[model samples]
Structure formats: structure tokens, C-alpha cells
Target: MKKQYKRFRLRTVSAMVAMAFVANAWAVDPFTVRDIRVEGLQRVEPGTIFASLPFRIGEQYNDEKGSAAIRALFGLGLFKDVRLEVNGDVLVVIVEERPTVADVEFAGSREFDKDVLKKALREIGLTEGRPYDQSLADRAEQELKRQYINKSLYGAEIVTTVTPIERNRVNLTFTVTEGEPARIKEIRVVGNKAFSESTLRGLFDLDTGGMLSWYTKSDRYSRAKLTADMEALRSYYLSRGYLEFRIDSTQVAISPNKQDITITVNVTEGERYVVSAVRLDGNYLGKEDEFKSLVTIKPGEAYNADKVAETTKAFNDYFGNFGYAFANVEARPEIDRANNRVAFVLVAEPSRRAYVRRVNIAGNNRTRDEVIRREFRQFEASWYDADKIKRSRDRVDRLGYFKEVNIETSDVPGAPDQVDLTITIVEKPTGSLQLGAGFSSAEKLALSFSVKQENAFGTGNYLGVEVNTSKYNRTIAFSSVNPYFTPDGVSRAVDVYYRTSRPYEDQGGNYQIATAGAGLRFGIPFSELDTVFFGGALERTEIKPGTNIPAAYLAYAERFGYKSVSVPLSIGWGRDDRDSAIAPTSGRYQRVAGEVGVAGDTRYVRSNYQLQQYIPLNKQFTLAFNGELGWGKGLGGQAFPVFKHFYSGGLGSVRGFDQGTLGPKDVTGSTIGGPKKITMNAEVITPFPGAGNDRSLRMFGFIDAGNVYGENEKFRLSELRASVGVGLSWISPIGPLRIAAAHPIRKFPGDRIQRMQFQIGTSF
Candidate 1:
């Protein structure tokens, strides 16, 4: 019976095909020589239909041409049904146009914005004003669901509604039911014998919901995150002498409700092997000694994958420094099962030398090409030196005008010894409007605002205006800097400022000091990380007399008059190599500055030196230290200017004392800043609780010791005030913020202590 039915089905298909051929032959004959007419087009133009027709007016038409015309019109995606008819010799082309999408809307979607959903649909050809089909609507629903799945919304449901409107148009509404996102309920690590399960799980960023899970989202299950976590797990073992460590399998299981997930990582921690021997086995360009020095793998120590990888990378980079762009360096291991040891053979291959054919820059929509090109150390038509290319990339990154910078090397076609360098950069907004406020014990409320353009007009210049209003101090300043002033890496800067300072405690005495100055400076690049600066400034200071003025200020006014003018020469040197300017993990920074009052009413010299160092202890901890020293002395038989003294005991110095209130005092019991200053700070920083390894949010414990001394007083350890505190540092949207609550370990009589303080734009 089955065989008979199959024969009948084949006969039916053949009969249908024969009928179609006969009907096509009858409908279209070989005659044409007349005009054509189109029917059933509302939005699409008649010319569009005529353009797609295979046969034109006054042309012979046949059955093959009629079939081709129907196919061509349908291929345009504008028509749903196309028919060709013949009335005598006048050809009639009829089409039913697809509905035009009038609008796209979303409802009941909280995980994504309406515009975001629209954009996602548009990428898949389902936007408004385009032809609509049932298949397209079905695809839009699947795409929306996929987007939600990425957000861990496994139970999300999308229902597409197609509403027919007037003029053969339709409205597409994607109503989304975004259910609760799936949370990670547990993480299990199997086959880790040397470490506890909890310890192994702690290495992963995905965790069972923590108290702060809402912000970190670490409790969400993500395939990408799970992959990264597995890599970390493998690295941890390999770095600790488990030479044959590997991840066997990773299983992510979702609950029946799709609201909870469990992740299990199975790993194999093989035998721990020690290094037995290391040998060089390949061509080293007759510089074996030089290449051997770059090996970081210890012969007698436990086998470390990190050290092995470092050695190989160093060899490759060294080879690239000599124009060998295609150098291959590999470390092959020989395992000794009985002795539990491994031997490494370093193999090196330096391919043909290459020169840069062209250096291309891209993605700088606003910045000029020259602005980025000038920073490159590796130029076109030069030998490809990897070191120089790396330096060039770093230089452009330090410009602070780009959010991302990448360099790619590609071989030029048909050229064996030539390559092209493409430097792609993602530019960021260089203009900023900053509004800051800080609260401290002494300076109760302080407000600051600044407008700055780091890359003004894409000329690699800086222009800024700053204003500060505090109860004890007020300032307004304007500054401009040209980084390429003379084209030899020389920088020129100009500054104009006005400032007023008063005592923290008013006490009905409005005695104040007003100063105004303007300066021009030039910086000469001594090296890649060092700069020397020299400048001259003209300044005027006026001391307004009132009740309860400090005796030192009164004496200075009596000696040099109430108003004084000075022209000071300034010289400074700075060097910074920190990994990050905002959140440093490792590096050192130093600065030395001095001012000499060569021709002024105040004939004194002042100098200051500061050093900061950041040491990364591990993946999650950093140790930082900062120290500053300042000194001023009378010169030409004149006392140091009272207004030029250094002040300590603030957010940037000792934290447990009031701002600028840890120094000598006047007879009226007001804090008077001194000419000598010393500050030392040390902190241990770690990730904030439940934040995983995010460095932007962190907590720290700090120890601060510093003091200010009168010019006549000697530097003594007993006079140094010390404090221990815990602080929070966050790279917030506004700026870097720090909050500290400290307890002074040592305090003297009449010392003003402020235990809690918070401020912006400070790091310690």
C-alpha cells in the first residue's frame, strides 16, 4: 500500500508541472510591440515596476520573459504577489505591495529602553518605513529574546503584535515580559585537592548572591564570565607548580523556574613539577648571551607557566627590536615522570626582516592626523622596531584624549619584507565641566568649579578656568598650555590667578591677605618620563589690617610694608611612570620645585620635594607610600614671606587634624602656618566588599605622620603627630573621592583634631 501511494504522489507532481507549462505557454505568446501598464502600487512608483521588468515597450515578449519579469519584481522585496497578463498585445503587470511599517513600539520592557529595542530590530531589517512580512516579525521576537538572555533573563517572553493601519501600512509592537533575572545560587569546584572548595570558588567573580550583589551583578550567570573564571582557576594552579593543570569541563545548570543557576567547574591538577634544566636550542642571531639574559625561568625552582610565558615573550620582543617582525619563540617541555621534574628547550626563529610601508591612523573623527602622528616614534619607511612601536602607543595613550588605542601590524600584499602599521584610536570627550564640593572639619563647606578642554580645538593644547569658594579661601584662575610649543617636545604654559586667604576662625576679625599673580612657564622634555620646567612670575601681595591679626604677619607688614611686590624665578623637575594616573597599582612619581625671590620685596628662597610610590602586592592588594618635604629660609638678610609658608594637617597630609591647624599658633590662639613642612603617608588598598576585583571602588587602611614647624624651630620626632585611619576611595562619576575616619595616636595641648573628613580630587 505504501509503494502504491508513493507512485500516486509522484504522478500528481508531474501532472501539476505539465499543466503549469501549458498554462504559461498559453498565457504569454511571442508578441509585444506595444506599451505597458502597472497596477496595484500605492507607495512604490510606477517607474520602479517598469525598471524591474525584463521586457520593455516595443520589445518582443515571450513566456520566458514573462516569468523573468515576475521574479525580478519580487526580488526587489517591494511586492508580495506579482502577475503578468496579456490583453491582445498590451502587457499588464499587476503587483500587490507589501505593507509598509508605519511605527515600531515596545511595551512592558524594563530591562531595555524602547530605542535600544528598535535599534536591535533595525539591524535585523524590521524598522519602520520598510517592507513588513510575517517572517520578519517572527525574527524580531527571537532577537528580543536573545538580548534578554544576555542579561540573564532566561524566562523573558516576547509577543509581536502586527496592527494593520490605513494606506497599506502596519504598526509593529513588541510587548516584552521580562521576568526576573537568573541568579547564581552556587558555585562548585571539583577535583581541587590542594585547595578548599571555598578557596577555589573565591577566585571566581561569579558568586552566590552577596549583600551588594545588585550593584556588582556578580551573582548573575554569564557564559563569558564563567570562561574567564575557568582561565583564572587554571592559571592559579599553573603558577603554583602544577605544570599539567587544566580545566576539564564547565557545567552551568539552570533551575526549572529559570530564576536560579548553578555553575560547576571540573579541573585536573596534575603533578607539581620542578624545573630540572633549561637549554637554548635554536638560532639566536649570534647573540646567545644577550637572549639568555632575558630568561626568567629559574632552573632549580618549581615550574611556573608565568615565568615561561614571560621568557618567550621577552625573546620575541627582543627579536622584533632588530626588525624581525615575525619572530617565533617557543618553550618545549620534557617531562620526567619518575623525578617529577621538567626540562625546557627554548627554540627561536627570526623570520625575514621587514620595514614599515605605511603608518595609518584611524577613528579620530575630530582630532587632526598630525596631532596623533607627531607622537609616533616609529615612522613610515623605517625598520619595524617593536620597542619604538610600543613607546609610540604609550605616548598616544598618555595624551588623555582617547579612551582606547590599538596598534595592528599586517603584511603588505605582494611584499615579503614590508608591513603596514595601523594605529586605531577611540577618541573620548576632552572637554569637561567639573562641579565639586568637599566637607572637612576646618573648611566646613567648600565648593569648586572648573571648565577645561584637554585637547582644545584638536591642537593638543589645554585651556582651563577654575573657581573656588571656601569660607577661609577664595580663588579664581585661568591657565593655558601648548604641548608642542617649539616642535621639539617643549611645552609652554601661562597662568593668571587671584586668591584671598583668611583665618579659619572669624572671631569678628576680617583681616585677610589678597594676592594676584601671572606667570609664563616652559617645560623641556629631558627624557620620555622626565621634564624640566623654568618660569618667571610677577606677584603682588597686600595684607589688610584688622583686629586679632597674627603677630608674625604684623611684624612682616611692619618690616616690608602692608603691600609688597615680588618677581620670583621658578624651576622644577618632574618624573612619573605610574601605571594609572587615577588609580595606580605600581610605579614611582617624583617632583622637585624651587622658587627664588631674586627681585622682590620678599627676599627668600623656598624649595619642596615630593615622592610617591605604589607597589602592587597581589592581584587584589596594593601598598602605596607618599612623602613630601618643604623648606624655606631668609635670604639677603630678610625673613621668609609669611604668606608663602607651607601648611600641613589636611586631607592631603595628616588626616586626624584640622586642615592647616597642626603648626605653630599666635598669641590670640589662632593656627599660624610655618616655613618648614613634612608629611608621610602609607596605605594598603583592597577591593571593596562584594565588589570582586574592581579597582574603581576600594577600601584602604592608612597611617599618616606629618607636621609643620616654625623657621627657628628644629625638626624633632617628638613633635610629629601621627594618625591611623580607615578610608574609602571611589572613582565616582564626578571625580575621585576619598573619605577617612581617623584617630590621632599622638596629640599635644591646644591641638585641633578633626576625625572625619571627605573630599574630592585627592589621592593618598
Candidate 2:
């Protein structure tokens, strides 16, 4: 009987579908809707039917009106079938309402969340509580397929099943079969005569799977990546003097099983061209010579599109500084095929100056508006200065509370000379809890932890605590910083710390130097790239007696009665122009710090200076150089305190040597440090193999030279120790990791060699 009922239901549904199609052509003589009635509605309201009819109670109805009403009802997408009928002076609307979607379910969907799919379906009118149509179901299926294609899942399949439930509702189930993502089988470049195909392919991010494929994921095929790779290829050729180079075509094909993809790019390598002349053509505002000086392209040099673009951008920025926010700059190239050379004319059009009507902030869902507004150097109602605007944007970005920051200027309505600037920001987490570990031949196994909030409670204040647990060195510290402590952008910071250090771990029985201190500091901004620092600290140092104590430390402990108190005053200056603090490509950073012990058990003066410069050789290569120097002397004819010494070696100083092991040693063969330190490092950095131009993962070859000298020891080249190494730097989920395998270029009999060294979450 159940089987027979199911067959009957199928037959009835088939007949109803046929009738609906046939009704499209059927017409009825309509009359006034004196008392319209509706049937076959389970969820739809009666008024809905009344509102859909074209004829009112007192209006005359005709055959055309009856047909039009039927079409209008169907257009609502709420009914599977709509019909209009008349009985004497009355009209009736019969509607077989579509089922409402009660719930949506997913199975075997790992590529995306079920809610994501439901949200996408909701956009197309197929969500729960809404009418369900078969056409809408088909569109949802296509949307799912599109999403899968973007993930390289070419073999993915989706089956949507609709099952009728109680109360004229249905349950939708979308079963997904997500196969393996398509991998790049091969990348071929055709008609590249100047460069080898392998070399060109090497420039692409997408490639066949390799040993590191699981980590880098560069083997996957993506249309967006392919497009970017093509652009890079074009840029490469243009920058290398192929000014007329053109891409012929590109073809990407998938395998029969959809598990592999191949890409072929065809290009025409035009003849290399050199620059014949460069000239400024438009009004230079009486600064034609100044504008000409900004030109980087020179005659007799290879025609570089990058340099041309840079020169134009410089012109635009220069104009912007003078309130010409809408300046137009163009580089017009005149190619001479006969001589294989090109001439460029720079044209500029400085549009009318405009004042900023308003400065709007957006997308700061967590951070307060004041936090962002305070960083702006450009004010509302002020003439637009491009340099100041750019600086303001960078300042907000440097706050590090946002993942992305962008600014757009739009013309204000009815004000030809007024514009509004909208600053949009995408906020990221401003808090982090880091747990790190490190292993060094000298320090051995060390564990460190830190909890910091850069924007505390969204108030734009920094608070942090840190602890380090190593047998040779242990420390606990607390710190706080307020960047806007002073209305003029001066920053205030407070720090308190306790540290215990064992100078020697190899032959040590816990002979240690301990210190406890607190400090307050202020940073005064001198310019966009410079800052001056002033601070004072009160510290106390204590020495604990133990076996195998270094002679220098023992003598100091005896002379100072095992403890000493000091008041130190510090002054410092710094300048930074790096593009990024984490992964700088080009810029210079420098610092000079000095401290004097004014009134204390130990009176001395210390000064330190450091300089770092990064030069970008090209898009993928950089050269970095760093140098550091330190010196200390005792005042009032007292000896320099042993606890206030400097040590060198290990990752930051000399990678091949053990940590703090390149300095003077005591009689018991323990490193006692020294009063003078010098270190210099040079590195050639490049993108990691198979990682394309990713800066977060890089590899570098470095040369290091450094040593620590005693107070009476004079600086000498012969005393410098050096090493050479290859290293890798990865910005991992937890923190930055650095590993190096180094070899010492200079060594002594007692020098400690530690070739493999690594650390996490700390700078070198």
C-alpha cells in the first residue's frame, strides 16, 4: 500500500507540473474581485494573494488581467503554480506555495564551513524560512562548484538533496566530494630567446611539487597566482631592457583526472633598447631643473620601465607636497626601432589645489577613533599635502594594531575645491602571549615567556611582562609604555626587572651576579625618523660566593663587600627609516646610547653605538650591513665594575663561536667578559628556494667579525675574530626562527666552536 501511495504521489506531481505549463496559455474571463478567496496556502498570508491580483473589488477585470495576475503571482517565486478563476462576480486566486527550507546540512565538506555555504546560499534566496525553488537549488550547486574551483579542487562534486518535511517545509542536504587539489604539473615558456625557460619558470610562484611543497604550498595551481606570475614575467623582461616585449598568449590545461594542471605562456621578446634621451615637457612651476634632477633614467643606459615609473611617481609626490593633490604625471616613451633606443618625455599637469573638508576614520571596530585620529599629521580644512598625508598613513600602519590601512580621497559634493579623505583600517589582534625556547651551545636549553598587549583594552597603551628561565641566565621583567603620554607625541615607559647571571656554565658551581632595578624613560620625537631618549634607573648588584669564581668577579666582590648600589642616568638617540621592522627590505637604522653612574658605590660611564643599513639589490635580493661598538670606563680612579662588562660571540656577534665565549677567560677557564666590545656583520639575503618572492621566509649568507677586549686592551684588527655562515629565517606561527650553520674563519686554541645555532622570537 505504501509503494502504491508513493507511485500515486509521483503521478499527481507530474500531472500538476503539466497542468501549470498548459495554464500558461489558458485564459479566463475575469470579473470584479468582489470577495476574493485563496486556497492551497500553508504559510503565505491571505493578504499576499489579494495584493498580487491586478483587479480590485470595484474594478472591471478582463481576460488580459486574469493572465497578467497569473504571471505576476509566478514572478514572486513563492509559488510553484498560480491560477485565477472566476465564479459570477467574484474572483479566486489558487496558489500551490513552494516549500519553505527548514534546515541546511552539509556532509564531507572540509574545504569550507557549513555556515559559509549556507550564507552563500542565503544570498541567492535559498536560506532557511525562505521559499525553496528548484532553480535556486541549481544555482546554489553552481556557487559551491565555483568556490571549489578557486581552491584548485577541480574534481570536487556537490549533490544537493531536498527532502519534504512537516508543515510544508524541506530539509536541504549538500553532500560534497572534495578531491585532491590540482597541482601544477609543468610550466612552460615558449619563444624566450634572451633567457632560458628554466630561468623564467623560476620566477613563478606556482610550480611542480617539490620536497618543501607541503610547507610552501607553491605547487598548487591558482588562476590569480598565474596572472601575477605573468605580470612578473613581463616586468622582468621590461626591466632588463626589452622595452617592446609583449605577451602573445597563455594557456592552462587540466588533466583528464583533474589532479594535475599545466601552464604555457607564449611571449614575443622584442629587441633590447637603450635610453637615447630623457626630457621634461610640461610646466615645471619654475623648477624644471629640480624636476630634471629627479630623473633616474639616463642616456646610454638600458631602458628600464621601473625607473621610468619611479621617476613619474616622484614627480607626483613632489607636486603633492606643494598642495597639488590631484597632480597628473605621465611618462611618454618614443621608441626608435632603427637605432634600438627610446626617448622619454615626462608630462605633468598639476590640477587645482583642494582643501580637505573632512577626515573620516573607518573599519576600526575595536580600536577607538581617537587612537587613529591622533596619529594624523594632516588636518581637516587644511590644504592637502601629499607628503604629510603619506606620513600620517604610515604612522597609523606602524602602530601595528591594524592588518591593513588605506586612505582614499573623494571630491565633496558642490565644492569644487574641497575633498574628503577616508581612512580605512582592518584591525588585527593587539595582544599576544608568546612561549619560546632556545638551544645554544653556551646557554643550553632555555625557555622564555612573554605576555603583551600593545593596545590595552583598546586604549592604545602598551603593557607587558616577560620571564626567562635558563640555567646560566634567569630574568623576570615588567614594562609599560604610553605613546601619547604627552599631547605632542612624546612616549613614556616604565620598566622593572630582576636578573641573575652565571658567567660560566661549563665549570661553574653557581657563582652568580644578581641585579634588581627599576627605570622610567621618555622618548621625544625629533622628526619623522629620529627620536631622543632620556631615563634614570636605580640598581643594586650583589655577588654570591661559590667555587671556581672568576678572579675579576672575586676581587670586585671583596672590594665592594659583596654588594653595591648605583644611580644611573641614561641618554640616547635613534633614527629608523626601515620599511618594516620584521622584514625590512631597504632602509637604515642607527642608535647611540650613553649611561653615567653619578652617585653610587660604583661610579663609571658607558657608551654604545650601533648602525644597520639594508640595500635592496632587486625585487628578491638585499644586502644588509651592521656594526656595533661599546666602551666603558670607571670615574674617580676606581676600577670598572666586573658586573658591568660586555661579552661577544654566538648568534648576534659571531655565529660559529659559543655564546659569550670570544672574550677574556679567568684562571679557571671561565668567560669573564670585558670592558670593550666590537662587532660587525654583513649579509646577502634572498628569497628562500621554491618560495618565490616571499620575504617572511628568507635565506642569507653572512660574514661576521667581533671580539671583546679588556679595559687596558687596545683595539686591534689582529684581535678580531671572524666567521662565515649560511642561515635561514622563518616567521612561523609562534614567532620568528633563525638557524645558522657557520664556520670560523679565525680561531684560537681555546676558542669554543658551535657551528649549528638557532633561536626563536629574538633579534640577532
Best by lDDT: 1
lDDT of each: 0.88, 0.86
| RMSD, one per candidate, in order | 5.5, 5.4
lDDT of 2 by residue, 426-504 (tens): 9999898989887655667899999999999888999999999887889999999999898899999999999999774
Instruction: List model 1 lDDT by residue over 454-571, tens digit each.
Output: 9999898999999998878899999999999987889999999999997556355778899999999999999889999999999999999988788878988998899999999999
Superposed Cα RMSD, model 2: 5.4
> Which pairs of residues collide in candidate 1?
none
Model 2 worst lDDT run, 10 consecutive residues: 1-10
- Where is model 1 more than 4 Å wrong at Cα? 1-26, 36-51, 85-94, 163-169, 434-443, 503-511, 544-551
Candidate 1, poorest ten consecutive residues by summed lDDT = 1-10
Listed in order, each prediction's TM-score against the native is 0.92, 0.86
Q: Name model 2 segments beyond 4 Å from true.
A: 1-137, 161-174, 434-445, 546-551
Shift of residue 80 alpha carbon in model 2, Å? 6.7
